[model samples]
Target: MAENLATASYNRRHDLLQRLRTDGRLDVSAIAEEVGISRETLRRDLRKLESQGLLRRSYGVAYPVESGAYESELSARVDSNVEEKMRIATAAISHLGAAQNVFIDEGFTTQLIAQHLPESEHFTVITPSLPIAALHWA
Candidate 1:
């Protein structure tokens, strides 16, 4: 019975990870219902995934971590927590003082920050990305 339970646990966690990978994120209540597991059981699965560095969980959501080298390619990362990235970028803008020098990186999140920065705020923008530099023309 113990072995069976362990196998069942493994299968459930595997399925949960597969779901997260496909959707980029998972809703706890929805996954628990779909997996036919109790919320407590699903939470345990999420915790195990967290320890594996396969995902980051917060409240009712689980975000997948692409394995190795932070996985380059904007197309690969854009779908991952897009809303969260936007929120983070917007929050970062709040920290900038007006007319301060800001160095934006080339990552997708930084790109979002560059795009979303309010026109009312002025800054000396420094970026290595051609796309961001092109913003000067827009």
Candidate 2:
């Protein structure tokens, strides 16, 4: 009996993912209604899918990465560097004052520098170890 219940749950989760593809996006209430399950149950199913990185829950909407065309679009935007980070750093450095403090928040590009910074390009560096604070040298 437990096995049958588990199988039914697995089937329900599978069906929910497929339905999201056709539907573009869904909310827990709507999915619950469509699948004839409780809202809590649908929420649980969506959570499992999210843990697998197969779906994203934003705001009140659950969207399938491929079906909604957002996953690939976001990846494309992030893939191309366009030298934005380098350009910004250059522009920031152009303004010259003897002593000034600047900070860039923790993010992907800055984290790389934190791990390994070039010895040649010099500046009065000020960072709260923008990647991982603990790794900062004393």
Worst 10 residues of 1 by lDDT: 68-77
Best by lDDT: 1
Model 2: per-residue lDDT, tens digit, 1-138? 999988787777667777888888888776688679887887888888888776888866899866432222322334557377556545545543443434544554454444444334443556665243444432
Kindly report which residue stretches of model 1 are placed more than 4 angstroms away from their true locations once superposed.
68-138
Candidate 1 lDDT over residue span 1-138, tens digit each? 999998788767777877888999999999888878899999988998888788999879999987752233676678889999999998998888665788998988998889877777666789998788677524
Scored against the true structure, residue 121 in model 2 reaches a CA lDDT of 44
| TM-scores of all predicted structures | 0.48, 0.45
CA lDDT, every model vs. true structure: 0.83, 0.62
Q: Judged by lDDT against the true structure, how good is candidate 1?
A: 0.83
Clashing pairs in 1: none
| Candidate 2 least-lDDT 10 residues | 68-77
lDDT at 84, model 1: 94
Where model 2 places Cα greater than 4 Å from the true spot, the runs are 67-138
